[model samples]
Target: MSDERRSLHTENVELQRRLEGLTPLLAEKETKLIKLEQEIEILNNKLKQQIKEIENLKINLEEKLKENLKQKSEGERIEQRFKLNIETLNNELEEREFFEKVFLKIISILKSPELTETKIKSEQREASYRREEHERYQRVIDELNEQLQQTNERFERLERERNELEIKIDELRQKNDILEMELELAHDKMSQQQETSRTLEEKQRELHLQEKEHRSAQVRAQRELEALQSLSQSLANENKGLREERADLEERIGELTEMLNIRENRVKRAAELINEFLERYRLTSGRLKQQIGRQAEDCEEFDRLIQKLRQMPIPKPGLVQNLRICGRPGVPRLEK
Candidate 1:
């Protein structure tokens, strides 16, 4: 039983380790999705500002064109640059959309509970098997206990029989003593009746026969006493052996009880841990879905900005170039 318990403990530890191992990967995926969402938001805001500036430039360009055609060259050059910027923003938007789709796929995969369910089911099956085995051992112990009780009862019966035999032997010995006294009295009477010599001889012969009968009875009583003593000793040894067997069975039952408790506790703890992890996964998945929606909104805002840019006119190169400078310090170069 102790061996069974140790095996169960080992199995529990292994299962817990397997479940814990999945957490880090889930966390990593969530972190990456959040970072991507943040980047998309920043890009969207920048594109919006650029589109607004293009609209303002277009408004100024029309007024400037009617006043002075000499500025046409500068206006054409600024319009070309603005188109290039719009193309770059469009490319960035396309990349962000692709990444957003990939992020959704990752979230969907993470939300799946198939693997966790399988693991939990497997653990439950193993626990059930152990419980069955424990019950089997318990039954065996019960049977051994009953056998021990029966053995004890038999020993008690044997002791009673031996006591009865001893009493009978004592009675037999007293009868032998009484018969010997009678034989002695008969011999003296034979000696006194000496007038008829032949009659006296016949009486002496009868007294000798009675002595022989008494001796035989003594011998039979002694043999019965010896047999009873031997039987009693054998019964005592058997009782001692039964007691030892009972003790061993009791110890085994104790070990099995301890084992069962340990297994029950382990299963409970594992269940709790799995629940916690599952709850955390649900929360993270919810946040990821929200972020995905936010990203989609940001994409739509960028789309609106692109349309505004297409409707706009040109701007002075110097003014637009200065405005296009990075608003945030240490921001990385905007990729096409």
Candidate 2:
């Protein structure tokens, strides 16, 4: 930015030199100076606008980056939560398997043939232990009944959790779809911004080219003015020859007029083409909603220029001889 400022300063210094060189030819130096000032002012305003746009784009990108980071963190947190839930479910399943094995073992011990064979040999011992055995069996049955109730409760809780997880999964799917749509919209916005940036860059390049061309034109105009001064001296001394030259000059003027008409037609055609492109661009933007206005943001300058041209009165006498600003499509330039 500083470099650009420096370059503009250099150009201003050069322009001052050129303006000094043209002072002798110019009858209204003060008026021309004021116009130059206005032109420079306009250019500065445009530069400021471009800077503002760049800043806005930077801010937008920063916001998008933050949003993406936030979403990523949220996704990671959800993933961790799911992992913990799965681990807890697996541990509960293992515990349930252990309980089933223990229950099977208890049933097998009660039905064993070894315990029954000892009944005949130790009838007195069996009678003495029978009450204890009955109490132990009752305790085992109570424990089995409690375990069964706990298992049933666990199963019911697991089913409830499974249903809840299903609901969460559905919610997550919907959120995923929403995020996808948001991503798509972000992509579209990025693309649109990129397109606008490219267009502005192209306009800047064209302006630079036009500036260079304008400088060359100034040099040519300076030379032409010098020639005109020399011719005036020669014409003052020779009447007949000067009259012939006057006729030739008139013919040249007519040709120039025709050339001007052709240029005007071309400019009108270019404007129409630009309008057509704007229409299509606007329609596309409208479908997406926002970004492109009904009357495009970039077209304001063009509209102003066109209206100014339309309202311009016919030049009279000496006004045609003076160099002045002529607003064209991409760049404004001096015309005699």
Model 1 ranges with Cα > 4 A deviation: 1-114, 195-336
Per-residue alpha-carbon lDDT of model 2 for 32-106, expressed as tens digits? Answer: 445545555654555555555545545554555555455455545655655565566556556655654674466
Give the clashing residue pairs of candidate 2, or none.
Answer: none
lDDT of 1 by residue, 1-336 (tens): 223322433343343444345345445545554554555455455545545554554545444444334334444554565556556655655665665567556655765576567645654675576557556655655665565556556555555554554555465456545555555554454444333444444554654565355345434533443453354345435434544655533443344334333433443443344334334632343343333344334334333433443353443334443323222332211111
lDDT of 2: 0.47
Give the distance in Å from residue 39's predicted Cα in candidate 2 to where it truly belongs: 38
The alpha-carbon RMSD values of the candidates against the true structure, listed in the order shown, are: 76.1, 27.8
Query: lDDT winner among the candidates?
Result: 2
| Model 2 regions more than 4 Å off | 1-132, 225-336
Candidate lDDT values, in order: 0.45, 0.47
Task: Give candidate 1's error at residue 81 in angstroms.
Answer: 98
The backbone clash count of each candidate, in order, is 0, 0
In order of appearance, the predictions have TM-scores of 0.25, 0.31
